[model samples]
Target chain A: MIPYSKEVLQHFNKPHNYGKMKNPDGVGEVGNIVCGDLMRLYIKVAKDKKGQEIIKDIKFETYGCLAAIASSSMLTDLVKGKTISEALDFDRKEIVEKLGGLPPVKIHCSVLAGDALIEAIHDYFNKNNKLIPEKLKLRHQQLQKEKQAIEERYKKDKAV
Target chain B: MKKVYLDYAATTPLDSEIKKAMLPYMDKEFGNASSLHSFGRMAKEAIEKARQQVAVFLNCRPDEIIFCGSATEADNLAILGAVKIAQKKGLKPHIITTAIEHSAVLEPFGQLEKEGVEVSYLSVGPEGIVRVGDIEKVLKPNTVLVSVMYANNEIGTIQPIAEIGTLLKKQSQKIIFHTDAVQAANYLGCDVQKLQVDLLTLSGHKIYGPKGAGVLFIRKGIAIEPMIYGGHQENGYRSGTENVAGVVGLGEAVGQIQKTKNEIQNIKRLRDELISNILQNISKTSLNGSREQRLPNNANISFAGAEGESILMALDQEGIAVSTGSACASGSLEPSHVLMALGLSPEKAHGSVRFTLGKYTTEQEIAYVLKVLPKVIERLRGISPVK
Candidate 1:
């Protein structure tokens, strides 16, 4: 068994912001069984006093290992009530760091959480017909390509 | 937290009596068995006694038992060693084995395939049981060996080893029949005549004996080309200074099994209760493999919405040791090959967990597991993206 950090085990044992969010402005599902990490994020968006969009609430549903679940739960805690732009600045490293550390092989799980966030924000922008940010678009495009390769790998190995 | 070990299929703890039997060989009597003096004679005498005990346990000739470092080595000796004799005789070898064999058997066959020897991997049905007809379908006149496990390591599904053994005997006097009986030796009380196998493998650590000692029973009159060469130990079949203490431990363990053979009923009762309650208390749960034809100590289950790794981690937190077929748990993206060969979807395989009982398992431990398991499964299901 992998030696998980105390923080990681705590979050995994009782993850926060883990469930469905009703009437959410956006939802994101990323990763797949092929990579051994499948996760979905739900977010509700609202306007702040300054008329800039902020995340009112967030939640996640993940089917994965300790690191994946811990990363998902930590991602939600990191970005729950932040402005959309601040949440957009979320890096995969922060989750790994906030959890103290993760195994090198499991760093990709944190990336999944970050990718799911980008996907959720993109969905929110598209749904509201808001001007999409350039950086979010590029990240979304990369995520799509990565997901396509993963799906192909799944198809290739299904014969086993 | 109270720790409960339910992963006996992985390996068993050393038995106290076996430890007592092995102590002197490790210390005072540690002389090399091949030396030319009283020290050597004493060590050699101890090893011979261990051999006779194992022979009695398996009902084979004492000289037929060869002690190796581990069950994996024993399996390699039985499979690869037997085929080398056929190679020397100038016969093209065709080997038949099930797709679910341990890597010890499979990897040797794989290497043989690369060397242009024909090999057939027999598939098992959803019950994880191999049919004798499948072996019959693939047997060729040149087939050298047919290796099947007496019971599966993962799901604890018992295979029809005796029937398959009988089939190979009736088909061709030339075909060598072998079974990896590492997991079956304790509860099954393997009698060589009853199993009718020309070659068989057993392990020490899997039956409450020390690790680093294993047995390969090769019937008399069957020839095997040795893999390792040196010191002329183990009839030149295996060539290392004997693992005296480990072999002594193994022999003691085997002797204890013969005495406690009837205790299997208690393990079966505990296992049945565990399986029944897990299914009844937890929703969307079902057992894997054929219930009636399964190992008495095994109860592999799949909880529909709970991912195996998460459940395993949760159970681990509560100090319960078990096993899972999930990809993440193994640090590999592939689910268990044995479960896949049983025709389970990858998702179902990911949800599967193995809980094996042993003689040490108590009713109180079972109750505690039943109490903790449902809550953990329910918690994981709540977080699962599936449902």
Candidate 2:
């Protein structure tokens, strides 16, 4: 078994902000079942006192190893009250740091968590008819390409 | 907190009795079995005695048992050596083995295929049992050997070995039948005459003996070319100085199985309870192999929407040891081929876990596992996105 940190185990054992939202403001789902690390992010966005958009609530559901689940939970906690732009800047490295650390092989899980958050923000922009940021648009395309590559690999493994 | 070990199918702790039997050889009686002195004669006698002890379980003669370095080597000697001998006798060498065989057996056949040997890999049914008809359908005029494992290491599914043995015995063309009984030797009776297998492979560490000791039983009058060439030890079949201490430990370990036969019922009861409780208490969980046809000490289950490596780590944190089908545990990225061959989807295969009981496993340990397992499943499923 991989040596999981105490904080990772805590988040994995009693994950915060789990389950689906009744009607989420923005929803983003990433990963495929074949890759064994699918994740879905739900966000409730609200305007703050100064009328700036802030994340009022966030929840995540993940299907993968301990590191994947811990990362998702930690990612939700990291971006709960942050402004939309701040959450966008919430990088994978910060998720690793918050969860203590993840193994090298599980670093991709933190990446997945970050990707899901970005995709959820993109969904918010698309639903509101706002122009998506150039950086997020690029990240979106990269995630799509990665998902496509994973699906192709799954097809090849099944063929074998 | 006490640690609970439930991965006996992988390997086992050496038995103290076997250790006691092996100490003299490693210490004072350290003479070469091939020497002519009195010390050498004593060592040779001890080796022969061990041979006879191992032979009793298989109902074979002492001379028919050839000690090797490990079960993997024994499997290679049986498959590669037999095919080579058949090729020497002007017979076209074709081999048949199941898809779920251990790497020890499958890799050798793969190597043979590269050498122009026609190899047929038989597929198993959903229960992980290879049908006798499937083996019969793949038989050819030049099929020189059929290798099947008596039981699987991952899922603990017991194959139809006796039936396959009988079918091969009825064939007009001579085909050497071999079974890797490394996992089966713990609970199953290995009477070769009853099974009708020409060659059988067994491991020492699996049966509570030391590692570096194994046995390949070649029936009388059957010949296979030697894989190792040296001082003509093991009747010129496995040519090297024998690991005398390991051999003695293995022999004593096998001999103790008969005395401990009654403990099997206890293990089976605990195993059954574990299976029933996990299936009953946990939702979206399913057993992996044929429940009735599996090893008495094994329970392999797949938890939907939860990855196996995560479950294994959670259980490990609780001081309970188990195994998972996830490739991450083995430092690979692919799930187990055995679970995949059973027609499980990639998701289910990735979610599978195996719990194998052993002679030393206690009822208290099973209860503790049962108490902690459902919570772990719930915790993981809560985080699962698949639902």
Candidate 3:
């Protein structure tokens, strides 16, 4: 049995933002075919009366396992109060850690959640004509390269 | 939160009696059957005794039984062995099997396909039993083996093995019939003569014995070649050091099942009651396979639209263990191929929960499950996107 932490189970049992927003500021979608786990992140980024850019609302729609649901719920909870920059800085490991560490098998699902959130934040910046931080962009590129390498390795193995 | 194990089809807990039967072999009586000494004689006698017990359970001669590592290896020996014999006779071999056979049978047939061996995967109807007519229709001049399973592992559907074997014997083609009786050996009445099959496979673990022990029953006159090459063992059929403890455990387990045959109906009734209670309490839920001709202990159901993993998780949290017809507890979330073959969509397949009853399952435990499962399904459904 997969050991989902109490916090993860609680959030998975009753997720925070479980539906679509009216018109989300930035929407990020991640498709995981290996496990058939799909997640969609809907972010509502706006300012209060003080004209400071703040996330007004964040919602998630996930069709996945407990780890996927909990990670999405935790992703929303972790990024709600943070600035766009801080939200972008949210790492996959931090999200996994926040859930008291998901099992090794399900770590990829948590990573998917983190990747989706960062993409959502980046989408928010892109739409607002704000430049994505150089570090996040570089990390994103690195992740893409790593994913490609893994896929290539799998293809080679399959060929053999 | 009471723990109840129903997935006995996947694997059964080792019975204490079988463990007791195996202990002496594992400790003081550990000796090679081929060795020339008192230790060897004791071990050899024990092995012969085990062979006799297994033969009695299957209603076959003691000489006909060959111990293998697992039923999978037994199946490989039977199918591949038959094909190689036919190939040597300058005949291009053809085989027939049901679409719903376990990977053990199907995967080997797949490998044989690469070697130009023609295979016909006969399809089962909505009832999930491969029709004898389908097998009749697919018979060829070179058909060497017709391999069918005694019972399906996923949906618990029992194939009409006796009828098929009887009909095949009348054909002039002389097709050597084989049935992978791994799932059906202990639970069902498996007499070799009544089934009229030349070969059959049985696994120990499925019937409350230690894992890694199985038997292959080859009728006295059947000719075959050994796939594994090594020192002569099991009359030069299966090669390797024998699993002495595992063999003793298997024999003991089979004996226990034989002694307890009267309790089969009671377990079936419990399974039926659990199915009836769940169906009566839950909404939009339906049984997956045939009702009348299924395993006595299986009740597979699909709760519409709700994710199976979430329900399984919720049930696990409540300490009631069950299995899904969808993804296994393994990391990947692929729905079960068995359900898909029955024409269920991936979504419907993902929603199927297989509640298999066992010897230790009680009415009160099932009642607890009947109470907790509906609430869990409702809760998961309430959170479901499709719902």
Candidate 4:
């Protein structure tokens, strides 16, 4: 068995931002079934007192392992109530640190959580016709490339 | 917390009676079997007695059983030893094995393949059962081995070992047939002559015995090279001082199986109940291997939307012990090669959980698992992104 941290187990046992969220501002679905991980994160964005957009609510539905789900759960907590910039700046490292630390092999789960956040923000920007950041564009391209690699590996495995 | 252990297929607890049988060897009677002293003779006597007991269990001669470190070593020695000797005889050797065999068996084949031996990994169907025709399909004139497992460790599907042995008998006597019977030794009676296997691997810990003991049944007249070298113990097939206590524990454990034969039926009953209740009560759940053709103690299932590790963690919190074949559950990123060989989707493979029952497993414990599992599955499904 992979030695999961207590926090990871707790979040996996009863994930906070779990379940399918209905009608969100943006939905970022990342990962794939073939790779054995998929995360669909939903966010509702509203303006604060200073007229700056802030995340009002967040939820996630993950089809993955314990670390994946826990990472997704932790992502929601860290990004909620933050402005768009703050949410994008939310480090995958912070997610790992807050979770007490995941097994080295499962660190990909945290990277995946960050990727889903970027995808969600990209979706949010796409929805409002806002200008996309170059960083977001680069990450989006990277995600697509990673997805193809996963699919290619899957095909090779199936062939085997 | 109400703790329940249901992972006997992984390894079983040491049986107390077997422990008592090993105690004297570990304490007062401790000695090197190779020494000329009386203590050494006593240890040698115990070692020889253990060998005799294992021989009786397998229905082979006492000299045929070679005590090894573990089943992994037995498997390595059996495959590498047999294949290497065949190669040494100046014949280009070809070997056949199922894709779903334990890594122990497969790794040696890989090693042989690197040494220019033609190796065929026959794929099993969705039921995780390898067919005899598949072996015949790949049977080359120079084929030296047909090393399929007696039963799978993950899915617990029993292969047609005796039938394969029979087929090999028709083909040629030159071809050595081996089976890793580690998972089947507890529930199934292994008569080496009846099975017609030239080599068979057995482990102690998988049964109610100590962890360190293992046996390789080398049918007499099958000359093979040794994997280890030093003290020339285990008939020089394996070297170094004998694991005296482990051999005694294994002997006592194998002996206990005959007396506890009826307990197999009880274990099957509990397994059936656990399997039935989980399949019936949990929606979107499916059994992974052949429902009827599996080991009496095994019930491997997949919950569609819930990943295996998530479900395992939930069950762990509930104080139940089980094992999962999910990629995430394993330290590696790769999912179970056994489940994947069955052509299950990666999702299903990542969700597979094996619940193996033991002699000590009771109906009440099965009921408790049935009670907790449905809720766990529902919770995970509720959180799952997959529809």
Report, for all candidates in order, the number of backbone clashes: 0, 1, 1, 0
Query: Among these predicted structures, which one has the highest DockQ?
Result: 4
Instruction: Please give the lDDT score at residue B309 for candidate 3.
Output: 73
Where in model 3 is the C-alpha error above 4 Å? Answer: A2-10, A19-42, A48-52, A82-94, A100-108, A111-160, B328-333
TM-score of each: 0.95, 0.91, 0.86, 0.98
* lDDT per residue as tens, model 1, B1-387: 999999999998888888988999878998899998999999999999999999998898999999999989988888888888998999989999998888888898898899888999999999999999989999899998999999898888888988988888887458889999998988785998999999999999999999999999999988888889988899988999999999899989998997667879999999999998988888888888888988899999988777788888899999999999888887777888888888887777888899988889999999999999988988988887887
Worst 10 residues of 4 chain A by lDDT: A1-10
Query: Per-residue lDDT tens digits of candidate 3, residues B229-292?
Result: 8878898999887888998888888878876577788888899898888888888888887999
* Docking class for candidate 3: acceptable
DockQ for each of the predicted structures, in order?
0.64, 0.58, 0.25, 0.74
- Model 3: lDDT equals 0.82
CAPRI rating of model 1: medium
Q: Positional deviation of A31 in candidate 3, in angstroms?
A: 4.9
Model 2 agreement with the true structure over A16-130: per-residue lDDT tens digits: 8999887888999997777667899999999999898999999998888888888999999989999998988887799999888888888888888999999999999989999
Using DockQ, rank the candidates from best to worst.
4, 1, 2, 3
Q: Quantify all predictions' global Cα lDDT against the true fold.
A: 0.89, 0.91, 0.82, 0.89
DockQ of structure 1: 0.64
Cα deviation in Å at residue B33, candidate 3?
1.5
